[model samples]
Target: MLHIPTWKRIVIWGLVVLGLVFALPNAFYSRVETHNDAIQTIEMQGSTPELVADRAAWPDWAPATLVNLGLDLRGGAHLLAEVQVSDVYADRMDGMWPDVRDALRGARDRVGTVRRTDAEPGTLSVRISRPEGMEEALRLVRALAVPVATLTGAGASDLVVSGAGDTITVQLSEAEKVATDTRTMRQSVEIIRRRVDEVGTREPTIQRQGTDRILIQVPGIGSAAELKDLIGTTAQLTFNPVVGRTSDANTRPEPRQKVLPSLDEPGQFYIVESTPVVTGEELTDAQPAFDQNGRPAVNFRFNPSGARKFGDYTAENIGSPFAIVLDDEVISAPVIQSHIPGGSGIITGNFNIEESTNLAVLLRAGALPAEMTFLEERTIGPELGQDSIDAGRIACLVAFGAVLVFMGLSYGLFGMFANIALLLNVGLLFGLLSVIGATLTLPGIAGIVLTIGMAVDANVLIFERIREELKTAKGPARAIELGYERALSAIVDANITTFIVATILFTLGSGPVRGFSITLGLGILTSVFTAIFVTRIIIVMWFERRRPKTIEV
Candidate 1:
């Protein structure tokens, strides 16, 4: 076990030196981080003298990555939101109304004139003028049903069509409901992530909690309320043809149209078509710009399909007024002066620079499919986070000191060798964590402290084995070799068992528990390398130099 070749010794020392070099940058984390940020800014924009000086403060070739502090370590916001998935089901059925009407209208002679009636939220109820043609009406509606493409309900149809008396009801099938819920949840997560990312904040945790809830954590945000405001908006935008303008708030709109209050003018309402010409889902880009009147406005461009539809609509309806609606309210009503075929348009609203900029961000991120209700919200203060970090640092230092003193006193020079390995073990841990940019939480600090003590256990076992070998009539060299060889099995068994436990904790735990498991697992790996491989190298080099015949254990 002590017969390490020259090549192996060189490789082992090389790794230790590399770990120390990587870990050294963390000792001056603030300066290194500032230098890294400066370099990134220079790369993105033209570099100034001040930025060049900041970049020169730290070497670019050195590892600049630092451990990411978690929300507990850095002040941030936490919010738990439950998505209203059933809302999508209702919206889905409502959207299908036009298709259903057109299909049933094709067979008007047999099914008779059909009129829609109010039913449950997710059910579409229609009354046929003729009761004798109910069977034919069922066949027509059934023909519209398409198979659901999901793992659980792959072969089943997406819609359920049932009829009783002259009334026919249409609703999503069981399989379709599951598929819709899954899709809604996925879209909600993606939209939320995009919206948060658009704010240009640092790393944010956006994870699905269960079937209906999402857990969001954003470090360095001011408060939960601020984060909620950023993502709470549905930002639904639409353009509809204006049927008429009205002064009365209670004025009734015509069929297939609705009354919405103007955002700029108070108490002014416009009756516009409920069905939109185009939705915000087609918008590809939006930026804040000045309008023809030099007013703050939002400029938007559409995707290919949206551009085609919008172009056709504007070309066909010249000189007619259309309303730019946002979140159910008409933001502006502008008359179409000429054919707009470019697919780009400007929205003039009563908006300041900030409002225009925010609106542009929302448009660029797209709209959420459904609304969300916040179940829990919290804001951690920076002062408290700093206190926790200070306490953790002190605890780690104290634990490290105690372990080093105990190991040095118990095993003499060999214990000192173990202590050197233990120190390097910590450096290696930090090096690995920095390389991966792992988030460090309060519990993670505790895991590191625990590892300090555990790291010395292997050294103690080996030292005791050497003492026993000394008493059994053996030379110093032979005793050292036998000591390491005999202790190898026990060291591997103990570390492997502890490693398995750490793996289990990581797999089953969440949040802070997961942070603890990460450090514990990584500490085990680094400690084993330093204790077994590193300490052996140091002892062998020392023994070879001294050539001691009578060694004192």
Candidate 2:
């Protein structure tokens, strides 16, 4: 007779029943649901299956958990970035009050008569008549205040400043460049991820490359072009005075715009370039609504400092028009009627429902810390993702079949019981996955097949030990108990190593790798329970019901 203690028998039975609870949630969901399945178009107002999952109205729930698909599985935009550490350092140096005050002193010394200058943070400005000795004075100032020592000090004048606006450019060394690049890329990744998340791009992957570069992948994104513009656009707005008559800039053939770029009210326009006087980092919130005439508009709120700068701009250029240029296209050019305060203002542009809503999202997300240049863009349609999924399932089926047939051939009647246990093991794993809401991937399916083999091996080891005991001519019950006690240590030791390896993979791997690790980890846990305890109880029950004259192999 085969023997199992009453408490031990209950424990094994309890595990089998527990698997049913894990699988029950499947009744509410489908394995392959279409877009129509997602929405109940004709759903009645009452409480029904159709009215469930109506959390769309909630912004926080816009990108809900249940539906996070991969990049290739869905279509979306991709982005690559190379952060400008030199630019960041230059901005910091130019903004220093000591540097700005010193540059002002040098300008007075060289020109003998100081003209107007705009000395903002991170930049020193000296607007003389483009003076005779202006070049030398700037050289002297750069050497004193903005030294090439802090940057890559190789330049024509030993100062790496651009003379485009009488600015010196300094180059950085290999070491300084590498460190700065890495820091900027990491910080930029965090900020960009937050912005994209707010915009509701599903499961966007933002990661850092070797040093200065970054990669972003988003799936199921409908507005790839708009997202591209938002990602790449330097949302830098500046206000500067019109040097000559306001109308002269507009007349210039090269810069073909109704209004020329100006700080003054009389001639103001927005310019799109890699640079910006004020970045969107200063903005806080944004909302969408219709203007007085029912035109689509966005209400954007800026930080206190940004609001003050904007207010001063409005007061100085009351009658002139300022262009709202995004990616160099003039969205609107509104004249300032009065100063804007309270840290918030509105923009009226000819926009539709979606565009206006997205603009608000972009503005609220603030500006990208630096421009990100795209290196690669790969799009995978849903048709291909579905095909891959189908193939993966077929592979799993084949693997399981092989494991089952081999186990039954080797173990005879005992192998048949092992096959049943393996089936239960797989059902329990998926049932737990579906209930816990883990997204299934191709690698995850592979983890299941791997679980099948391990489950069979556990049973075979125990049954083989029982056969060895029976050959000693002892009673059937004594052999069965000794078999379980002896094989338990070996089975646990093998599975423990695998569990630790899965844990390490989960910790270090990225994206899809993590999904496979998670499935393998969960599969390992479920396999141990069903294999050791459940199989023991079933075999014991068989012998208790009817003891065999000759034990099956």
Best by lDDT: 1
Clashing pairs in 1: none
Compared with the true structure, the alpha-carbon lDDT of candidate 2 equals 0.62
Judge candidate 1 at residue 275 and give its lDDT: 73
Write model 2 residue lDDT over 104-136, tens digit each, in one string: 566665544433344433344444444665676
Query: What TM-score does candidate 1 get on C-alpha atoms?
Result: 0.82
Which ranges of candidate 2 are over 4 A from the true structure?
A: 1-180, 191-205, 216-278, 289-296, 303-325, 329-342, 381-384, 412-417, 431-445, 468-482, 506-516, 533-553
Candidate 1 lDDT tens digits, 1-553: 3478999999999999888887888899778877977876675344899999999888888788787778888889999999999998887887777788888899999999988887888888888999899999999888989999887998999999999999999999999999999999998899899988776555688999889999999987899999999999889999999999998999987765899999999989999988788899899999989998899999999999889989999999999999999999999999999888888999988998778888998998888888999999999998988998999999999999998899878888888999999999999999888887788889999899989879988888888989999888468888998998899899999999999999999999888888899999999999989978999999999988898887866
Choose the strongest candidate by TM-score: 1
RMSD to the hidden true structure, all candidates: 4.3, 7.5
Count of steric clashes across candidates, in order:
0, 16
Evaluate all candidate structures by whole-model CA lDDT and list the values in order. Answer: 0.89, 0.62
User: Mind sharing the TM-score for model 2?
Assistant: 0.66
